[model samples]
Target: MNGDVHVDLKTDSRYAGRLQYSCSNKICTLRITDLRESDSAEYKFRFITNQPGGRFTGSPGVTLSVRGLQVQVRRSSVSYWATLMCYSSCHLPDHSSYVWYKNGQKIQRETFSSYSGNFYYPDSYSCAVKGLEGFPSPSVCGHGHSCNRVTYTDRSICAVKGSSVNISCIYNSYDTDIRSKFWFSPERSLQWQNPSQPEDLSEDSQYAGRVQVLETERGRSTLRITDLRESDSAEYHFKFTAGSFEWRSSLPGTTLTVTDPDLQVQVIRSTDYTYNQAELLCHSSCRLPDHSSYIWFKNGQKIQTETSSSYSDYFDSADSYSCALKGLEGFPSPSVCVYGQTCNRVTYTDRSICAFKGSSVDISCTYNSYYTDIRSKFWFSPERSLQWQNPSQPEDLSEDSQYAGRVQVLETERGRSTLRITDLRESDSAEYHFKFTAGSFEWRSSLPGTTLTVTDPDLQVQVIRSTVYKNYTEAELLCHSSCRLPDRPSYVWFKNGQKMESVETSSYKDQFYPRDIISCALKGHEDFPSPSVCEFNRLFQRRYNTN
Candidate 1:
């Protein structure tokens, strides 16, 4: 060995990762590993020749400095909507990509080059919690541009991998400056998803790539997944960034269920019919109502084109099962048996609640047995007062203006049926009854109707300015209550022997100061037309207007 040579490592394993080296020594080769700075010095070379004084020499050699990349948040002090820039002080070359981790979560990455300057190339980005726009102070964003930013994005829920869902987006910023918005799969894999804007879009695999954001507003996005698989159940997150701002977002996903139409036949929506011309109705309700199909079959024969809204929408009509609804999938099964209240084997479910014009409530029903083979189910409210379903006393599903389409059946089948009602007014309050039929047996229960007592919230009423007109201009009567019940209570104002219609709503907040519950006010009640003193009550309790 006569020459002295030097090998300078651009980076050691630590500054980067790990290092490996091998040397061929004479009759055999030598291998060494796990090398670190501790072994940063001398090496000797030897040659095994037949000569005893064979060649042997020592050389003072190269220094290998491992420059590994370590990232850190500049400042620990942080607030909502703040931006924290990342500072990387490393003299490294354009090798592999750089990955950024936030709160231990790996964000997008960045690509560095020999010619790229740290100042021109941003490794620091801004972050806002959720979708709120505003700078969160003292924040840290990893720099390594693996993916671009997502801006002005919206999210919605739907069956997984079913169909790509459209999420609306908006961007008032520059278009060319922003490159793209990246879609992360349930597994957090980065993939360019379909941008569903300015046209029709489809769901993708894992989202089927069916998701798309507007090209102009790439940050605004919509997700579409097709052939929804159960494994597709998970949360999907998206991160969008443009020249100056970056947005990080995520959505909690939902599950997918491919359901079959629970078909069957029966008539029981209206009044008690021992045997009369009562209307027979059928009903079908499911989470994804569109997936369920309806067919009218009699004695193993499918009936086509003869079902009415009444015949197929209800189960126990005191009437005839003469009509059927066809091509209507997602609806409960069809019914052929004429409805009646015959055998005392009576069975049913009833639940109810009360609320003011601005509150919410839920109702439910159930049968005696909770079987599985039983396919179809139905629900009806006596308030519906269906006419044809029950001639003598029909609880019409179509005739009741108050009930409308507000009722839905919660399918916990083989057992109870539930319904959710929202934004209830006083008029929405009532003793809602349930009539469900599974298998060949029909059940009706109404003894203890589900009672919902939605007491009115305090009402607030007052003319914008004043109610003192020159000759008493029709004073506006405002009726307001924070009552949790939807059924609104009718108000009767009496001044003398005269009657006045007390109209208007919402008076005041429920809890005021310390103990003041609420207040309601109504106008137009005069002492002459009927009675100036108006009586407002729910469940028969007069609520004196105090606002």
Candidate 2:
């Protein structure tokens, strides 16, 4: 079409490398490697015979469509089971047998049509034809959907403010004609039954741009809310409508409790480092459930991994300590310093490092050890550890799936070690510490491991005005990150493109008036501040007047 021959099956430079053709018994077969979507076309094969005028072309050329397989999930008639079908627009051979996989592992051999089994999660399934087993279809999860009902994976969850939480459930509809799916908290007095109300909570200004509804195969819907606040603590429900029939489920719905992190340090003065002497316990103001586990920190460094509510370690009165729930390390308690510990022996160059996503961070620490020959030197972070490991058990954090390719242990000198992480993800935000083994003695540095905060920063604002009490009206603007960051992060606030002085704290309190445009961002990351949240005096007037 562009003054060039397009169909050069034999000599085309691009196709020459992969295209192959064989002619035998008057049948010509053409094969190409790594087919592209643009390869869809019809090609007629002309045959030439030894006899005069024996050349002829096939009347109807074969049409080839190159496309990937997509797996469609259906609820089986049998309860708790799902049927996965792999589909391709190009008609497959009649004799094709299907191969099935569960969580990327082959589960079934040559079988007919589809695969059926008791599906469980966190396992997902996909299917492929016998010959193209290498390129399996996209995975579809066994979403725990019951017959025409909605089921939650967990009935209750706890989240930290400024962190994200996901509320998920599996739903089913026998009608097959799904019109809509949504998540909402009836506590807000917003119900789908109200025709005027938006079907999804994301449409509400309060939750817009902050809530995400993710759907997987077999009707699994997960509502992920970022920058959670105290007001977010509530029971959440899911609803879906099929044709004319609709169902909203609140029975045993997911209840989320959001809390702020508070760390209290208790130190006993003693000379020796032991559980009984000069011991430190990281405490929380509010006790979690008995079954919940605890993580301990010395200064800012993690020191204990006991699952109990409190962590006790041989920390001197001079050392600083903190604590947090095991799974909720993102919301670590504030560090409290004792009279003093020898934190001077080994300390991080920077107490905390905040960098943008995809950026690299270097966490360096200087140390003083009596022993000279360091046998084993390594670096690890709370993000990589599920439980605390004593010096006796040294795990290769480099081998961890999360840090495998992203971490590097660097030692520039005898007394200094640097932990370099690349391509930072939100999960990489954690306190990294250095460990060394010197001839029969093992040491894990404490007090302060370099805390890294990897953020694709976003700002969020919450208006907290108590109409019932009529006490006060104030808007609290906060710089929010997807992950929990240092509670004391300095913030910069702006009003109508003008910087506001003394607005350094994360949450800015202001008596906002109508038509006031305010925004906030992290100290250094002021470029992408929060979208302006304007307050309307009319709404505030109505709210206060009612109460």
Candidate 3:
């Protein structure tokens, strides 16, 4: 029927609300909705006219077939359990009977929006709607660890102001129906006689659009807060309810500490060492934990634990010296140089770095000590929460499961140390501090070590076209990545498998073609280019074919 006189099914009760018809500029349209399993049939149109023998039936009819339900797995974090939701991609009648399976065998039949279970790593599971049990969803494996009770991945987190952090926990429940899950910061635990009755943080305007709960799966949840502020600092806890049984984590919940930037002194020392003279240096860790003044001390006495972080004076082999924050004198950093032992002030080259994922990065720092015979030097992560505060590193990071064989303690000599990590993963991102010890002095640089960020470059391409002109086939291609690098690298553009000439910027303008493809990547990372996207000059097709 050449875009005219489309059949109208509004008057038929069987097709009411399921059919929609309209005619715009002689282009007739018919739409269907709320399809059911029994709606399969051959559809045709018939046209009628006022003159004799003017009625005609459509020559060919279209048959409609519907697909079954699909399943989606949701989890709070990658390291938790999952909840499977069986749903149809399109509108369909609801059904209560749903079957779940683990590795091809049926496990449960229920009438709930979500099916819950413990996530066993490497074990595959799936679900299907009752009538279509034979066509179950593709099997998926559970990621991360399995927990028998509610547990947090980390008990405390320190974030930089304006950065984001995720507070994640795993929970288990015996109740069949989970009513709610949320995160909140309560000043006192005594107030929570009924933990489930507390208000959700998302409802509070202070965190209106800035906070979100990631309930990706049953028994797992994560509270993500973005654009952090000092006001957002609090002890956060997670709560959940399944039917009548409600539970809140009693363990020390996740504590968030946000710090702003401040000015701190940098320790600079001379490499020259003499038998009769010893030098000691002290400086700010990164720029600001922002200690206003630094006090230097010698062997537990306040005599000359002076105001400056750096102090250089003649040394007797038996004399020892340490430093402390000016006002807070109780806990002084471990003494640096003592009794001709390794005593040095350590400093990092760069406090923070955002590196590409799957790439290698070097976290470098320099140190100055009185003892030329350095006893030990290594790197550690303060956020890792392990008891590594010792004269020697607690364990070789190269042997740690996360960094196994991927981490290298670079050679340290003449006041320098480095940690080189390869095959960078998102999990590798952290603030790595350096530590060293000689004879009687042990030092851990907690201030401004290297903060490494591993990011996967996700390129997003935006296609723009002229709105007013027809057959004017100029398309604007704009490329962007998920992260903003410190130095903001230039973009690399590719067209039809070849580098584009003079298209080094993120935005490029080009004339449209039927099969012309364009893609982009980071200037130095062109090997992994983004998926090529083709631009179609729809203006040309409309002007030539629609007439």
Largest lDDT belongs to which candidate?
2
Note the Cα lDDT for every prediction shown: 0.36, 0.64, 0.62
What local lDDT score does residue 434 receive in model 1, on the 0 to 100 scale?
52
- Judging by TM-score, tell me the better candidate of 2 and 3: 3
Off by over 4 Å in 1: 1-156, 160-164, 167-176, 188-219, 244-246, 250-268, 272-293, 297-301, 306-547
Q: What TM-score does each of the candidates earn?
A: 0.27, 0.31, 0.33
Q: How many backbone clashes does candidate 2 have?
A: 6
- Position 269, candidate 3: lDDT: 25
Model 3: per-residue Cα lDDT over 1-547, one tens digit each: 2267343344333453355667789566667764545567677766544444566676687777765565576876645657877776656556557776553346755556577766665344556666754345544555433312355665456664665778898766455566887888875321233323566888777887899888788667999988887778888877767666555533356777765422222222223334444345543222223334667655434654367655666666544466656654533555545334544566577767887887788888877655555687677786565745553454456557788878887665656777899988998888887776677776654344577888867787667433313545566878876554436478888877788878788888877665667789988787767788764443444434432
| Sort order, lDDT high to low | 2, 3, 1
Q: What is the C-alpha RMSD of each candidate to the true structure, in Å?
A: 28.9, 27.0, 31.5
lDDT tens string, model 2, 1-547? 1274123354333342346678899677888765656677787776544444555677698888788677777776776688777788878888888887654456646376766666654455667778776455655567643334565655566665666888998776656888888888866652233422435678767776789988866679999998887888888878877767666532336778777644454553444324434445554433233455677765355755565644444545444556677666765655555544333245567767787777677788776444567687777665555543654354666767777688887877877888888888888877777776666756654444678888776567554432212443455555566544545678888877789997788667766665567788877667768887764343454555432
Per-candidate clashes come to 142, 6, 12
Query: Which 10 successive residues of model 1 have the least lDDT summed?
Result: 536-545
What is the lDDT, from 0 to 100, of the residue 416 in candidate 2? 84
Worst 10 residues of 3 by lDDT: 261-270
